[model samples]
Target: MQKLKSKANAKANANVKNSAITTNKRLYTERQKSHFLVHSVACLGTEVHLAACPLEFNKGNSSTGACEDGMPAVVSCVAGPLYTHNVALKKKLKVSKNVRLKGGTHTAEGRVEVMRGGKWGTVCDDRWNLQSASVVCRELGFGSAKEALTGARMGQGVGPIHMNEVQCTGQERSIWSCHYKNITEEDCMHTEDASVRCNTPYMGYEKTVRIGGGRSRYEGRVEVLQALPNGTQRWGLLCGDGWSTKEAMVVCRQLGLGYANHGLKETWYWDSSNVTDMVWSGVKCTGSEMSLTQCQRHKVFNCQKAVARFSAGVICSETASDLVLNATLVQQSVYIEDRPLHMLYCAAEEDCLSKTAAQANWPYGHRRLLRFSSQIHNVGRADFRPKLGRHSWVWHACHGHYHSMDIFTHYDILSVNGTKMAEGHKASFCLEDSECQEGISKRYECANFGEQGITVGCWDLYRHDIDCQWIDITDVKPGNYILQVVINPNQEVSEMDYTNNAMKCSCKYDGHRIWVHNCHIGDAFSDEVERKFEKYPGQFNNQIMN
Candidate 1:
C-alpha cells in the first residue's frame, strides 16, 4: 500500500512539472513571429537536393542556384497553442467584483468606482478610453462600452480618486485588474470622475413596438407594427384582456426601457391617434422574454371588448421606485374625525370619497373619517417621478400645488373576510421630501413650482389631518374590520416591489370610538404569519350594527 501511494504522488508531481514546462514553452513561443516557411531535403538516387516548398525569396535570388555544397537549408515553423489551434481549449479569465458603476439611469451607464481597503472610490478620467471603459462595463454585466464619458457626465462622485491613466485590453474582468497609476489627491478631482455607457443587445423590436399619443415617452398607448401578407407594415392596437405587467415587461425591454411600472388597460385619454383596429390579442408573457413576439399569443384573434379605448398601454422606467410604508407611524397616528358634507366637495368631485358618499343627501350628512399618517419612503435607486409631464399637471387651487398624477394612494376599509366596505383615494399627491438620511439633502418640494417627486433617500409624509386622507366609513356598520392603505395602488407608476406597497391593520369600530392595532407592512410577514393575521378574530363580537 505504501508503494502504491508513493507511485501516485510521484505521478502527480511529474504531471505538475510537465504543465509548468508546457506553460513556459507557450510563453516563449508567443513572443516569436506569427508565420514562417518550411524547407525539406531528400536524397534522390544518391544525389542530395533541397525539395521545393513555399518560401520567401530574397532579392534576385535563384531558388535552384542558391543551394550549395555544405550549405544547409534552414526551415522555421510557428509554435505555441497555434500549433494545435484546432484542438486548443480557451481558458476562462478570472473575474473580480472590486469594480462598480454608480448614479446612472440604468446599470449600463454610470460613474466608475473601484473597491480598495473595504471602501469604494472613484476612478479618474485621465487617459481613460473605450478599452478601459469596456472592462468596467463587462465587469458590471453589460456588453462593451458605447461611450467613455469624461468630466463627470454622470455627476461628480464622492470619495478618494483611486485610479488614473488606466490602460485595458478590453478583456479584463475588473477595472482594477487593468494597468493604472495610483492617483494622488492633486492628480484628480470629483469633476474628473470617469463614466461609461455600455452597449446592450438590440432586441429588434423597437421599430415593431412603440407607445403613441402620450405626454411622455415612458407613458402612452401601446401600438405594434404588424407585417401584412403583402409585406407592408401597419400599426394597430392590442387587446387588453390578458395584458399584464409580464407582457408589459417585454414591451419595455423591446423599447430599451429598464422595466414596466404599470400595464394600463383603458388609456381613454391617450386615444387621440384614432387607430381603432385591434391586431393582436391574448398575449401572455413570463416577464423574462426578450420581446413580445417571444411570448405566448393566441393564433386566432378573439376580442370580447375590442376598442381603441380598451387597448393596452404601458409606463416604462429605467429604474423602478420602491415605496415602503412607515408601519410604526400608521400605528401611532391612527385617529377618527367627523367631516361635514360641505367640507368634502372637492373630494366628492374628484371621486376620492366612497361610493356610498355619492348617495348622501346634499349638505346633510357627515362622514366618519378613519385617518392615519402615511409616510412613504422611496427606498429605490431612482426617484419616484409622476408619469405625467409638467404641462399636464393640474394646478389645484384648493391644495395650492400642481398635482402630477390623478391618483396616488388608496385607503380602504375592509371586512374581516377581505371585502372592501368603504374606500377613499388621495389624488394628485404633491411629492416632496419630509425627511432624509443624514448626508442626503431634500431635492424636491411642492412650493414655488419646484420639481416634484419623492427623491431617492427621501420620504413623502401625508399627515392624518389632511383632506381626503380618510376612508369614508360612515355607512360601514360597527364591526371587526381591516384598514388597508396601498400606495401606488393601481400601479400607475413602476416600483421595485408591489408586494410591499400595502399596509394593513386590524381595527374595531364601535360606531363612535375606533381602535386600530396590529398595524404592519403587508409583505413583511411570512405566509404563515399572514394567514394567522388574516384569520385572527378581533376583540369585538361578530355582530353587524344596523
Candidate 2:
C-alpha cells in the first residue's frame, strides 16, 4: 500500500510539471499574439490612448516581440496589478456591432438576423441555399455552413423580414456583399425565413467556464477554471469591479449562449457556490470580442473587494423584445382639434402643451392641438419592462397616474431637410397592457398599482383623446413636413433592437385641412427608396408652401 501511494504521488507531480511547461510555452506562442501585440508602447499615465504615448517605433529605441523574447524600453501603465483599477475606470468601451442570431440553443447555429437601417430582421428562405448560408457562417467566424434550412425551421423572427432570395457562390467573405432579390409584401413572410447550422470547430470552451450557482441554465455567478503557477487547476471566482454588458456579451458567446440580457456586478444572491478564490480581475472587453480570453486582464488577482459575494455574474436569454409603433394608425389619426384652455387644467399642470400655453388667457384663448394615436407593439420573444423598479415611479396628481419612465416617446415634425419645425410634447407613460393576442394573458394593468410592462404580442395604446398626447401646432405655418414618432427614444429600457422604434410619415398640411400619408417604420424600406420620400414636384423653390 505504501509503494502504491508513492507511485500515485509521483504521477501527480509529473502532470503538474507538464502543465507548467505548457503555460510557459503559451507566453511566447501564437496564443499570446491573439490577445496582444508587443507594441513599443501601451497606455500612458495621463493619456487615455496609446497613440499619445511618448515612445516611438523609430530605430534602436524599441525592440518589439512576444513577452518572453524581449523587454520593452517603456513600461506600460496598465502592466501590473497596481494599475488594473485605473484602467477599469478609464478604459472606454467600444460600441457594439448590431448583429445577433436567435432561436437556437447554441451560438453557432440559429436563424440569421442582420441589422440594416437600424433594425434586426431575418433572412427569407426563398432562394436560401448552402452557398448563401456558408457566407453567413464565415462572417460569424465559424468555418462554414453544415446545413442550410428553409421555411423557418429554427422558428420565425420578428420585426422586418430581410435578405430575401440570397444568391451567393460560396466564396464571398460576407453576407452583405451577396446578391439578393428585393422582397415584396406578398412574396415572403417570416414563416418562410432562413436558418443555418454552421460547421463550428469544437473549441471546448465550456470545460473552462461555468455558471456557479443559479436557478436556471441561463444565469448565475461566473466562475472559471484557473491555472495556478504550479500548474494545478481549480475553479476561481471573478472580480466584479468592471463587469458590464459588454463583458457579459463575450461570456455568453463563449458559452454558446444566445445573448446577454444583463450583467450583474455583485452576485450575492447566487453565491451558493462555495468558490472564494478571486483568480481573475479587471476584464475589459471591447464589446466586439467573442471570448473573455480575448480581452485585457490583470497579471495578478487585483480586486478591491475580494469577497465571493462581489463576483461577476450574467443573465442570458434566447430572445429580446422589439417595439414598433403602428404607423398606419398614426397617419389615420391625424386631425386638428381646437382644445379650450378652460378644460386643460390637467394638461397645464402636467406641462403637456407648448410653453406659449402658459402666457395665454386661462379660460379664453384655445390652442390648436395636432392629435394622433400611438400604439406601441412588442413583437419580439420577451416582454418589454421599464428599466427602473416601482420604487422609482413618480405619481402625477393631476393625471392621477404613475409615470414609470420620464419620457417614453418622441414626437417631432421635421422639414424635408431634416430640420425640426415643431417639437412634439413628450409623454411619460403609466405603461399598461391595453390588450393582448389570443392565448396571451395580460401581465400589467394601470389600475390599483399593478405591475408595469408591455407583454409580448400586446400593445399599450395612447389614444388621441388622452391628456398630453397631442402636439401644440398653433404657431406653425403648414406645408410639406415629416411626422416622426420614436418609441423609447431615450433608450431607458433594454430591448432586442432600437432601430425599428422610429416611425415616419409624410404630412402635407394646408391652412384648413391636413393630409398624412406614406407612413412606415424606419427600417421598412431601403435607403434608396427612402431618399425619394416626401418629395413634392417643385418644392426647392417653396411652391408647395406658397
Candidate 3:
C-alpha cells in the first residue's frame, strides 16, 4: 500500500514539471518577425514587423493572419526604406512612377507589371497612400526599402491593366491593391509635393500685403499665402484707381487646398508682380466679398475719414464684408440763384410751405414748384426794405389811427387769450403773443371805446365730435402738432378784409359746401408758430381746414 502511494506522488511531480516547460515556451517564443531595408537602412524584429501591419486590420483573429480561406494579407510600409520578401514579390506589387521604389520595376504610362500571372492582369490602385506601403514591406518580413509595389495577380494577366491611379499606402501588399479611382498624380512640383515637415504653424510674422490697395485698377496675378483647414482661401494683390468694371487676373493653385466650406472662407485677391506662385495656401480671410479676380484687398475704408486706405487686416467677420463709410457727406456746391419775385406773396407761400412741410417734410422743407418770375438784378451790396407782404410778425407792426386800427380780423390765431386788443379813436391793435404769453400783453389797453374787445381761444379739433378717439397718452410725445377742422356750411359767415386778415375768421357758405375761405392758416406766418406746436396730438383730416 505504501509503494502505491509513493507512485502517485512521483507521477504528480512529473506532470507539474512538464506543464511549467510548456508555459515557458509559449510566453518566451519570439513574436512574428519582419524585415525592412532602404538602399542603406534596414531593421528586423517583432517590433519592426508586427507594427508594420495595421493592427486595425491584421490581428490574430484575421483570416489573413491565420492563412485561412486563401484571403490575401495587407502589407503596409508607412515610412520609406521599403522592401519585399522575395524578388518575386516585387513583381507582385504596382508602383507610381512619381514615387521611385528603391529596387522595383519602372512604371510606364502609370502602369506597371507586378505578379506572375501568365497574361497581364489589371490591379486596382485605390486608397494607396504612400505611408501605407512603408508598413507593407515591414509586415512582409522584408527589410525596409524606399517605396511599395502593388500590382495584384503578379501583374501578369490578360486584358487592360485597369491601373486605377495608385495611391498606395506602402503598408499595402501592392499599389494595384488599392480601391479608389481618379487618383491625383503627385507631380514632383513644389506645390504638388509640398513637404509637410516644412509647413510651419501661422504665427503672424510674415508681411501680409493685400493684392489691392487705394488704387482701384489691377493688372497682375493674385495669390494666396497660407493653407487653411477648410479649403477656403484668401489672396492679395496690387491695384490702382477706377478699377470698377475692369477684370483682374487671379491665379488659383488648387493643389493642397481642395473643396472647402461654401461661404465660410473670405478671400482677398489682387494683381501684383510680387505674387509669383498662385497657390491658395494660407490666404484665408474673414469678411471679403470680392471673388479672387474681382476682389480688391484695399479700398477707401472710412468714407468720412477722407483717403483712409484699407490695408493688411484680417477679415473681421462675414458681416464686415461691406465696409461702411459712416456718415460720409459730399459737399455739393450750392448755387444760390437770384430768383425773381413772382405774384405769390412770400407770407402766402410760406403758409403753403408750412402745411406741406408739417406732414411730408417737417424736419426738412418740401419744394414742389418754385419758379420765381421777377428777375430782380442783384444790385451789389444794396439795402432795401422787403415788401410788407414778405414781412412776418417778426418785422411788421402798425400803430392804430383815427379811422382805422392795427387789427387782426381774419388772422387765424391758434389762441387769442394771450393776445391784447388796444382800442383807439381809429381802431384796435392785436398784440403779438402766444397763449402762455397772453397775460403780459394787457398793458396795451384798448385805445377806442367803440372798438369791441373780443377774445377767443383756438384749439385743434377734429371734424366731428364723434370722431374724437382716446389713445394712450403715453403714446403721444411732446412735439409740434397740427389740427384740422371742418365748419358746417349752415354755421359760416364771411367778411372782406383781404390784406389784414389773410386767414378766414368765420366760415362762409357758398353752396351746399361751406366755403372755408382761409381757415388753414399755417404756423410759418405767426409769431407764436413754434409755441403753437407744443404737444403732438394726432392726425386729422377735414374738408374746411387743413
Candidates in order have lDDT scores of 0.74, 0.73, 0.24
Give the poorly placed runs of model 2, Cα more than 4 Å off.
Answer: 1-132, 135-142, 146-192, 197-257, 263-314, 417-419, 425-430, 437-441, 531-546
Q: Write the per-residue lDDT of candidate 1 for residues 298-385, one digit (tens) a residue.
A: 8988888898888899877777666788877887998888888888887787777777888889798788888888888886657888
Error (Å) of candidate 3 at residue 537 is 98
Tell me the tens digit of each residue's lDDT in model 2 across 50-70.
455565343343333434454
Candidates 1 and 3 compared: the better one by lDDT is: 1
Structural similarity to truth (TM-score) of each candidate:
0.52, 0.57, 0.15
lDDT of 2 at 410: 79
Q: State each model's C-alpha RMSD to the native.
A: 16.6, 16.2, 38.8
Please say which candidate is ahead in TM-score: 1 or 3.
Answer: 1
Highest TM-score model number: 2
- The segments of candidate 1 whose C-alpha lies over 4 angstroms from its true place after superposition are 1-246, 253-257, 261-279, 282-299, 302-317, 358-365, 537-546
Supply the TM-score for candidate 3.
0.15
lDDT of 1 at 267: 83
Best-to-worst TM-score order: 2, 1, 3
